[model samples]
Target: MAIDITLIHWIYISFILAVIGFMLFRRDTTIVCVVGILTLAATSTLSVSASITSLFNSFIFAITELLPTILVISIIVAMSKILTKSGINEVMVAPFSKIIKTPTTAFWTIGLLMMVISFFFWPSPAVALIGAVLLPVALRAGLPALGIAVAMNLFGHGIALSGDYIIQAAPKITADAAGIPVLDVVNASIPLVITMGLVTTITAYIILMRDLKKNKTYTSTSTCSSSPIEETQEGLMSERMKKILAISIPIIFVLDVVVMFTLNLQGGDATALIGGTALLILVVTTCFAHKKRGLEETTGYLIEGFQFGFKVFGPVIPIAAFFYLGDAGFYSIVGDYLPENSEGIVNDLGVALANGVPLTKEVGVITLTGVGVITGLDGSGFSGISLAGSIAQLFSTAIGASTATLTALGQVTAIWVGGGTLVPWALIPAAAICGVDPFELARKNLLPVSIGLVITTIVAMFLV
Candidate 1:
């Protein structure tokens, strides 16, 4: 049967054009989002006028669906920012310096801290924490700023985000696409996660060690926030807030981990647990921050947090809407009840690829990993994850590869590339904070991360 362009196809095509145009022109992300919204609205209504109206409606819907996650992330960021302003961030990390006395130790400590913190609070907040508190210590300990940045990038954004054991957001997306239980995806993903973690960490250590051997003990006096340790300060929060954060955050996360294991909860359940905890914390902390003007200050902080979240994630909305058009779950929202056989973009793409591509589990893993790396060129780690999940569905049948494994591999590759290691633009934040050339930081990461990814892919193939 000859496939004809339907309203859905036209909408999808418009989204594609917007994406391509955004990429080529490097346009403001808001512009890209508007374009995508307009395209989807126009197609679903089958009229330009309706499309314009739908554009407004789609934004409203997208914002609504995204509100919870956005609020959760915003609150976390706001709390961290508040902690920094109050000096608890410095105090929180200060204790570690006692045990971490050497450059090597600084590297490992930064990497380890990033992994643990990111596993709970997530990479964006983790980055802020590391950059604020640990960067100075790593620098003084004789670890180069670039090295510290690489370690943070690899452990936090790459490894932690890929595994996402606690947050579970990544797995949830892939699990839905696979039409499988989230627990099934979670169970299947463990081996791949371990494999990638081991390979990436080991490769990173070796590279750092090699660099150390070539030069004698070298220490830096220049101060940068990207290093991992900072001078301790006081008066940020009441000693009470400090104590609460010190005791509360870890306890909540640990309890969450235990509950997940005990109940065998996975994916969205896990994400909900973490996000819910964050919400609770946000409320408590905001309340604490302003006991006098309780509602006003709390609202202000929340607004500030949401503003940051939108700024950070806004461009992503349109991109996600475009990609969501592919998944059946999201198609109804974007497509106006388009039939399965009619013109679903994601389904059509997956079906076509499944038919045309010769894929095995091993090939699928590598292909998705490569796709991740390619997408990472755009310099936002999570940006490629949705597309990666969609593509992973294509190979699941031929390769018998679980969607989780494929998604993990994609997450692993994309994060390393875009999370501030290989991509200069993404590395800029770390570089600027650490006072190093962004390109140099990127080049420094290329070898270690690439090697790690290759090894991790092989490991994922066998394990998955």
Candidate 2:
């Protein structure tokens, strides 16, 4: 069960630390990540020319692994776009708006509704779906735009994305790296996700209510985005048509969820089912909305969706490429350079260190939470989670801990911090959609998010 530590292992560890260092300062990690890959390749093949070849090969591997996730997100975004253009998005949330009569109701109603929509649409598009229609209704209820932004950011990105029960995008990446079942990660995440979601959203609501009572309206006027989503044009489709599609789309997605449960589809299979359904909805909705120009409009929507997907994932791919070297990817990228006794560099290190160091459960929990928060500093919220899963595997193997619990803890912390609640730049989508300052929204979320993370980390410690 014991294996020797090699030079390649040291290289992987050092570069991981370097990547974390870069992220902590809010700097990009792409260059550090690539350099790490090239170094690993160079050491493995012992040939500069071969090392260079392996660098590109690593990216190809990453893209191939990530393409399905990108496609599903792109297709869903395209579907949301068509819904917005046809004014169906408005129709979807209209029923909920009737129940919102006060600031407290506005906050909870929007936050909870955002959590649900985000489960289906992902948060970026969910922000678009909820904010445009529900924001005005929330604002009219006496909540400031900043409060509205916080609700959407926390509930959508913080809660929904951390769990990712529908898309399974976040869990898929993490579980794959941990070498465990995707449902293992998903099932383990349920409690941690609930704790984080309830703690953060409730704390945020109480504090926001206090602030709103002190100041009835916001004073800041600074905006980051050149355009806000509140400026979307009037409905393109007829009112009857918009209403029909609005009813039909949610039913289709609901049925997809039912199918997912019935078939026991958790990872890529579930995602494909949703993606294919979204594509059909997008095509059908575009035809009705654009009439004579439906064909051209559908292409344009697909192009925009793909652009959005790539732009969001551009920073992710390089970091993912670097982390993949920790396990199976090392053999693929670095060739046959690992020691004969090694299971994988990380697993080998775990066994060696476990014998020598004996990491306790408390230490394991804290380290994972720290790694999650630090990796999230790059602001993508997702770019470094492969590292989290790999680290979880190491610590779990070392300390005889629960890999699923540790992975879930890291996943929750990462999303709550960088999934738009604590990071200013990451807050842009929610901020722009709600017409508030991103930094202001981040500031508002700081205390509640920090408190929630601490509680969740402690809870994870006990779980492990």
Candidate achieving the largest TM-score:
2
lDDT of 1 by residue, 1-464 (tens): 22344566556656655654654443444566567666655556568877666565555655565565455456555555555555565556666678667878987888888889778756655554466456655666778776777778778767787667776876776567555566766676667667766776677777777878897432322122222222344543688677767666656666876776687664345556665666676567656655666577667766766666665445445454444444442444544456545434543443343345467776677677766775565455555666666677667765676666776666667667765566544544445445454445555666677677787788877766
User: Per-residue CA lDDT of candidate 2, range 1-464, in tens?
Assistant: 45788888899889978975665554667899899999988888889999889899889987776677667666766776677666787787677667987889998888888888678666765565465457656776788778888898899889999999987989999999899999999999999999998899899989988877787566433423222322235757778887888788778777876776677665456657767888988899889888899999999989977776665456667876777676567778777789887656655554454445447889888878877776665465776677678878988998899999999888888777767787655666676556465555766788899899999999998898
| Candidate number of the best lDDT | 2
Root-mean-square deviation of every model: 8.0, 6.9
For each candidate in turn, the TM-score is: 0.58, 0.66
lDDT of every predicted structure (CA atoms): 0.61, 0.76
Worst 10 residues of 2 by lDDT: 223-232
lDDT value for candidate 1? 0.61
Error of 2 at 213 (Å): 10
Model 1, residue 42: distance off in Å is 3.5
Candidate 1, run of 10 with poorest lDDT: 221-230
Total backbone collisions for each predicted model: 14, 0
